[model samples]
Target chain A: MQKIILNQTWKGMLMEVKRSSRTKTAVSVVVPFILLAVMIGYVFGPGSELISFGVVIPEISIEKVEFVDSEIIATVRNTGPIAVDIVMADINDRIYPAAIEPDKHLERFESAIVRIPFEWNEGEPYAVGLTIDDGTRFEKQVDVAAPSIQPTVEMITYFAIIGTYVGIIPVMIGLLWFPFISKLSRSKYKFFLALTVGLLLFLGISAAEEAIEISSENLSDVFNGVLLVATVAIVSFLALNFVGEKLKKRAGASKLAGPIAIALMIAIGIGLHNFGEGLAIGAAIVLGEAALGAFLIVGFALHNTTEGFAIAAPMARTKLMIGRLAAMGMIAGVPAIFGAWVGGFVYSPLAAVIFLAIGAGAIFQVIVTIMRWIQNEEGKLSNSSVLAGIAIGMIIMYITSILV
Target chain B: MLTGGQKMIIVITVVSLGFAGYLVFPAMDITAQEQPEVFVTHSGAVVQTTGDVLDPVYTIQEVEFDPEKYLREFDYGEVSQLEDGTTLREFTIIAEDDKIMEIAPGIFYNVWTFNGQVPGPTIRATEGDLVRIHFTNNGDKEHTIHFHGNHPAEMDGIFEIVGSNGGQFTYEFIAGPVGVHPYHCHVMPVEEHIGHGLYGVFIVDPKDARQQADEMVMMLNGFDTDFDGENNLYAANTIPYYYQHHPIQINTNELIRVYVVNMVGLDPINNFHLHGTLYKYYPTGTDMVPSEFTDMTTFSQSERGILEFEYEYTGRYMFHAHLTEFSEKGWSGVFYAKDNSQPNMEGYAYGS
Candidate 1:
């Protein structure tokens, strides 16, 4: 009877141990797989999304809006079946909460007359908008409402930094690679010079085309812009020439001076073009087409990456310091931020014409200087290579433009 | 002072370092410059003064459609007949702008789509139906719809079937498919047109149709954020994580049929894999019976098939590319069985 009891207890203990082991094995296998699946989702989920997921979205519209005394009376409708919470309305530059509650809820196909106490100026066209809490924003445009031109602090920051992001890349690459390029013999350097000059000339023509096309609606505007461009080009040419001669007299070496001056002028020309780009982005954003604006930023960022090559290629023969490159980057890229600020706030076709014209003219002047330099080198560079480079440059620029 | 070999090594080192630096620069993103408080003038000029002009860019305006919402299968119009007893499927494919969608968790692609959805709205018709596609270019560019199936030349969307900005074109054809067919803009560069979300699936049922149960149209596609002639994103039905997040719920005993089309342009090949089961696979929609019964299927560009199967057990079944690399990277998803009780309802669309 004692042996029988002991055997029964031993069987019970073995069974319990076996059960516990099975659970441990299951947990060990299942937990890691679940974790692995989550980790995979996290890594592959967001970055570089090739296609978008089609999800049902809530569609909201401002049905009716009017200012009553110091307050604004607005009717917003949820056209879709989703309930929208925390809708905020914008009047002028100030944002007024649309509802009295902590959150505004609009159910499916529901209408809510949100009495937003908006601060408005008498007789001033006020821009109005209503936004749901889910990051969906909408603007109500009245005939008397003025266009919104003031940029938010974030936008200003975006413009300021985007220039460096877009404009610094190519120039920095060129600057860094200059060491290897300088190692090339004199004849090879001439070919490089020709390629650089060809690229610059192409850019000059592009700027010219933009200036003319922008002012195409008005002949007088075109004439004024072209005249200004020509005048500025000649002035830059003469001014740079005079400065170069003076530097030659003082510095005792003309080689370094020529390259430095050319680099500076190229930076200035690029600055003007970048400003134009900034203006475009700002205008697109202010037009309430945020997607279009974002695309413009991306497209320009891509273009600027290549533009840096143009800026630094000419300095291949001249070794430079990082500080100078940084300064040059600032010189060329900083104007983009200012341009965005101006472009977003203002719609002056004349100003756009002027800015584009200045860029075209400055680039033209640089081209002439480089061409003259190349001619002095004579047969040191292959004219065919130069021609080929020009064609390549034009094709590349055109392709990049189309991509945008 | 250095030997030639040592000099070569130094040069190589410097070149490598420069390359490394260039790659790292974009990430470092040397913080953007400081901005000074400035005021805007009514005339559109910015000045370094206070209280000067109307504000812009800061005005919180309304946006068009929210793209973060989960995507669901959309129905255009149903099949109908005229007095002559001829069935007609008329599809209005409008190429419009400002339609952006989230392909992944936070990555969004702004696409010029047909009627506002990527892979457009799927068209379903029998073998001999008169299909009419009305194409409208409501966006900024010129576009045209070209079908990839057996159709008459005049009805072909390319070569003279072109529509300019804000213009329209109509292509009529008798729906005939050899399986699943793809329709897209055949404007000069087919890659650019397709890349911008201008393609969709066109399904034509066979005269002797197979036993129909539950059906799905899966257009295996990709998205290239940078136009480097390569796809950085891959998915089916144009939405990333679509099936994984919103599993297609089906009954356990019901036969499932999935029409898969690999619509990738840059990449050479794409594939499909089903977990826990194998199915009768028909490569190329023109086949009467499937050539193989397999759990995994591989396809190159433009290749498509009809995969048929059913589940006996009540559980979540995952389907993805047999290429494990491709499967985890946006090409994988879960299938909720007819008996699935708990559906992950995040990003679920409430209304039709």
Candidate 2:
């Protein structure tokens, strides 16, 4: 009876093992089909309803309203994250046909001019409303309708005067320090050269930062704006270096020629920087952010005065004619006038970024040249007086920049 | 008592060993690990991947896109006989730019699409057929459809700018050259338009159809999420790693014809590699004869070709971009070739 019972137990265990193996095989096949079915269901089923609500956020800012002849022209900008489409326009609560220049589509930060042919009485209150594609409306009111001021010769003269005050005069005043600097001892002269390096370094860094910020914020992504800035800066640096090397090679024989070349380079670098600053000021004035007040002019003049000193430091030992000094000052200042005209009339973010990048690159190249010169003069880079002068120079620029 | 050179060698050896240890130990530990724990939601539900759920602020809620459905889908358009007795295929494409989609796991991107989908629709036509596209730009930005084929100068999408917000333009052209081409937005800064998903496959068939086979459209693409002029995600379709997770099913010994179009912008070139088999490549499908029999092919932007092959055995086969960086980022997939004798578990009678 015991043998029979053990035989039955062994048979039962074998059967159980076979059954478990079959189940495992079945599971392996079924699991894949189950997952496939789930995936199909998830893909085609109504459970995955992608109905977006409250996602469309439309915003538009009416920057300016002007009356030209019988037409009411309004400049509008897309201020929201998404692009905005202006479909219809209304003036004084009545729908009117309007023409939008450069199409009705205003991409983010893109501005368009809406022209409406309407004869409006002077000094009358009117509400201008714009309707986007989604029927969201944006309205701006004009208390009194008046003819907009077109840019005139008087305006041109005014901008030129501002440029002179901010760019030319301050730099000329700082250039007067050349006579005093030429009398300094040789050791002090080395310190001033180091100081010039510090000033240029600060300027380069600030210009590069501004370029990056503007490109990232205002420029279109299609332009690869930040990359454009970086590329232009790198190219500018290499190109300036190449040119400087050529100049140095040509001026190899004379000790005086080296200082003149360095001084010219410094002026060019400072000129480019001033041009970018002028662009900012001009754009601000055109955008109605800056008033025709003395604060901005005074601040900019004080800030730009240090650039002249940087130029003069390189040419302190060299005897410069008054005509040459005047020409150098003009080279360091005249680009600002052109920059202001461009910025006020046809300001482009791409141009701003490129100009700033070029300025930064030029300044960086100047710094490198100054450092190499200092090493040549003093035999080593880590002099105590040089370090202190550099610190002081940077601090002075920083303080002046705060006012601007 | 050591010389300077000897001391330097010792220091170098010690630093390298430490560096190697830093890299190798964690990798070894990872290899020893089994299945990862399933991420549980706050409400006690098990999530398959961490990216299954995401914040809805930047991301649109549950974008309706199935890469599998798109793989085999084609838009043949409404066919009609013209006055001259030629075939006319009319299609209407609506462009939109206001949708944010989850391109990868938890990575949301603002994709500008044609007909509400990336890579748009695969437009198919005969070589001599007149294709008329009633293109409408409902998006807030300017867009245009430029076809990469022989056409009249006026028919070119450039020069003639289309305004946005209900702007309409009809592109009428005779499909020619008998090849697979790419149609994309030809607006200024074309890279941005293409990169943001404004491209599609255009297949112009020969007068006589080729051998009957399972045909598919594969548009290799990438996305620049950060807009830094470099693509962060790469894929055969819009979603990254989608094909890898859900392998494409195919029948063994069946001819597979794949029309591969590389629409990735920013990157200069992209490539494809098939594992376990070589394919008969027809460069652009312009000629009747096969150009080469190879397992890999490279393509510049907008370059496309025809890849014809058949699987001999039933198993899973891998296919991916030959460039390792692309494959690692998500431009890889698997083809599951099943034997005909197996049970029809897919529920569909048609072969892939």
Among all candidates shown, the one with the greatest TM-score: 2
C-alpha-based local distance difference test score of model 2? 0.77
* lDDT, model 2, position A73: 74
Q: Give stretches of model 1 more than 4 Å off.
A: A1-404, B1-84, B338-352
Docking class of 2: incorrect
Which one is best on lDDT? 2
Candidate 2 residue lDDT tens string, B36-124: 22322223333332111121111122335778889999999999999998999999999998888766644556889999999899999
- Each prediction's total of clashing residue pairs, residues at least 3 apart in sequence or on different chains, is 27, 0
Q: Can you write out model 1's per-residue Cα lDDT over B1-352, one digit (the tens) per residue? A: 9887658757965874575343212222123223433432223333331111112122122223322231334343446896888788887878875666654433455787888877787777778788887778887777888888878887787776455667887788888865778788877677888887888777788777779677777888877754556565567765544565555677777898888888888878888989878899987677878899998888998888888999988667888877654554456677767554555444332111
Model 2: which residue pairs collide?
none
Candidate 1, residues A1-404: lDDT per residue as tens digits?
A: 99999999888887879988788888999999999988878765778364455776667655445555445555555656456653345454233333322125555544455554444554466556654554355656554422354457876777667655555554455456567656777656665666666666666777767767765632232135466556545554555455445554665666776666667767777787788777777766665557877887877776665556666666666666667766776777778878887767553444665667667767776676667666766743457766666666667767877888
